[model samples]
Target: MTLYLCFCLAMALFSGPGAILALAPENEVPLHPTTWLGENKVTPVHLPKGRTRRLYFTLKKRADLMSVTVSPCAVPIEWSLAVRTLKDKPPKKPHWSSKKSMPEVWWRGSAREVRIYSYTGNDVDTYTGPVYAPASIYILRLKSNEQNTKVSAYIHEGPGPSGAFPELPSDPKVHILGVGMTSVTLSWSPSSSVVVKDGHHGSLPYHEYCVLVNHKHNYQSLCAAREGIRKERQNVQKRERREKPGKEIVWATLKDWWWQQPDALEDHASSLWDNPEDPGCVCRDVESVCTVSDLLPETQYYFDVFVVDRVNGTNAAYTGTFARTHKEARQAVTSLREGQVKWVTLSGDASSQKGEQLFRFKPRGWQQNGLLTLHTCNGTSKVKVTISSKGQVLSSEEVGHQLAQIWLHGGPSYRLQIQALVQSSSSSSISKGDSNKSKFCLKMQASSAYHRRAAPVFPATLQIKSFNKLRTCNSITIAWMGTEERSLYCVYRRQIPPDAKDIRHSSTDRCLDPEARPANERVLCKYFQELNPRRAVTTAVIGGLDPGVVYVFDVYLMRRWGLPIKYHSKMVRTRNEC
Candidate 1:
């Protein structure tokens, strides 16, 4: 009896408290009974050789188990452990063993003692298992030889209270808010549940969101396959019942086989649905909004959003949406031929002029604001132009390289005045020689009509020979010669009182008070009269001048549609009434 007692004590000491002996009627030995949260007990399970017995256990909430120990009460029992989430369904049975296999199974060798460890916290000895996801069904598939075996599973809880598990995060809701030519904006609702960590009572917020955008082609393939099936069915029904029995049946079968082939459809769909080298844009540590750019314009795109709990390295189900990018806008033409162009001579005359020649020409058909291109016909000259419309000067500047761009408003008549300083030997000779003998001529051209026909040029040069007042105190007579016999002439006169202000003097330099100056200095009081300069010397009389007042007179050589090429100005004091 003493020897028997000593032998039993020796066996107990060798096995120790952490180990369980394989015997009939399997029993679970809990290492830490105080930390025990849950246990799944399986009774005697009989399996054929090379067959597997899968045990499924669903987690009610998030759980961080310290260790999962599976012990076979019978010595000959061999087992393996595997786990899979609810989102990932268990693959079909006769499963092949590979690195890419789902429900990764770790086979514990056929031994009397088998233990798997998962440690939580900073404890070096703590063994930890895979983080069990909440609401996720996990399968602990065990396989063995042909034998009747009993198995028991002990799940050791970590630091938290027993049976207290966090629920899995809710699925995200995705929406495509806006689509641009090369970009798309997306927004989604964050998951409601937080990630539960080991030894912590509270949960951590979702840390990141993964987004995927792909071109949907599987749907198109499915639609086409259905249509092909429908057409094939109709064709089969239309065949006559009296057709050759075996031959017709064989032909119909061949036709049906052609319609059911999935190779072509699958290949087409695969080309479109393949994932890009760089996966879709990911929003790290983000909650809701994300914008993706560099997308193809006018193309359809599919989207998926995943709520991830970075603390636990777990994610929720995918949320999907789709959108199409906008098309690009067309550009406008900028050529002058296809558009309107206005030509105005702002400065130098058609002929060379000495010193400075200042003139203004209001081009016709100046409807819209556009570029102004200038051309220098003669020697190099500096030209400045001032653009004025509706009595307002819009711009005044020196044009560079004889080219200037100006903007003009519609519905208003614009006048462009060009001042050019030209250095020419002929102009200098004309200015230095006898003034009566020298003649200056200028030619002006109108803009082409609808930019189709060449502009018509008109002579605007005229020379005045003599000017004198008649016996009448209110009348005067003048004689002038023009280059063209058919040219017309206009004469203008304005009265100036002795007290009239001199407009040539600057307002700041004038000694008189502001009110003393004439309100209108540049006004022409005499009506313009047209004269036909048909003869070598033409005479015209102006009959409506104020007596005893200083008057300014101007004679202009006119063109049909352009400004005067040459003009003469003279001041005369009329004789007082007798």
Candidate 2:
């Protein structure tokens, strides 16, 4: 666990609602300036088991209505809120009012939001008391059972705004600039709204825009995020129950039942809010062009451009746009004749160079191995070449002027994709018939002799000393300290029996020794090349392993010139079935 998580757990244990209120008088966890209720505030309250917390706010003379909303963060907490009006001030000790305890409300998932409103309006039918005065104070007392959770309390003391949303800006076209295997670049037009000047010399825009991007997810309000998550989980649960007719899986929302779940499960359920990079506003405050990267290939994504009222937090979302990224092409582009080499050139025009150009080569049965080379023919733009087979990338290299070589594995067919890294200066000069634009050449030649297997060189800077592995019943997570040097890392797994004893004493170098190597080893996965190279640590998640099996994992660091250096991890046994 990280220190940050430990600190949060410690705070949750000792913190209380009154303690938090003393820290931030104006709701410690404030929402945006403008929302549906127009600057309504919220506080994160932690109530201990069988405890009551009292909160109050003064009502101004201009306001005749008071609204207080409580939303439990998790579980169906048996909670209640009592409300009463005081002429002068709130009592030091809170006494129960006329409001009854809230009823049992059930939601599909623990992360769903449930709202309970204690509203007091002048024309409300339930109210029997005289009209509330301007200087009156409203005191609220909240009580909950044995559950630790954070609840948002929205308090507003004035006439609510019209239920209708504000007008949205025109010309909301989201252009798909370019798309890659794992990323997409998007741009949109900037919008302007009416300005509201304050009593002083400065003024602010009454409306602004926020750009939200996600994989097949769209939201119009804060509550929509949680609602969408709940509906998705509910559908999955329904399908699972249908598959297992004998099993009874109740969607329990009780506080007592919720505590029975493992802490890891709850943490995983709530990770959507904790992940800073999760689907959210990529651009705000009127910025136009934005790039939403790190997306999964062959998946559709929704981009929403919402017009937000800066003064009152009302959102007018334009009809969202959806685009699906390109998947790996299945058919081979052309056949590679044995003992013959062919050169293919890619032009720099926007039409030809917008995305990755995939070229597949099918070598004849006689050809066992081949060499693939790439180099720039003209212009200053470089290119990235990746060779893959059966959707797995064997090697990837970026080259500029000099030739770059990558050995292709023995296969029936392999795919080579070239992506031109055209500079911004040269993009403006590209034309349909221009010959001076960026150009590159690709050459694949069949080779008779296999590359020589050289002894591995363990560089002091790139050597792996220690690493950590987290094991579940069916998966393992391997993480190791990273180095500044850019390289490729691949993981391979081999299963051994539980009774094996001499495996630990076996020579690790036998992996590279052709005669002594084990044939059961198979590739699992690799570290993504798109991640930051200078990161402090690199992690890979390997799934789909048999439970109750002992496995050995090996990592190979591929060198540019010599053979790869193999690093062995401590043997790990997956947990037995529950």
lDDT of 2 by residue, 1-578 (tens): 69998886678558976554565543222332212222255455666667666565544446555555454543334433333333334333335442322111111111122122343221111111222544333444555564544444555545553322334346656678887766667776654453344456544445555555555555543224344445555665677777767776543311001001112223434643332334322553455666666666787777666555544433454556777877955433555454444555666543553434667666434644555544344435577778888888887878775445566664657877777655575445555475655454444343332443322223333333323336678887765544355667766677886687777753243224222345556454354342344455666777788988877766666545333445545466677854
**Regions of model 2 farther than 4 Å from truth:** 1-46, 56-66, 69-139, 143-195, 198-296, 300-332, 337-343, 348-578
- Measured with C-alpha atoms, the lDDT of residue 274 in candidate 2 is 30
lDDT (0 to 1) per candidate: 0.44, 0.50
For candidate 1, the per-residue lDDT at 253 reads 24
Who wins the lDDT comparison?
2
- C-alpha lDDT (0 to 100) for residue 112 of candidate 1: 28
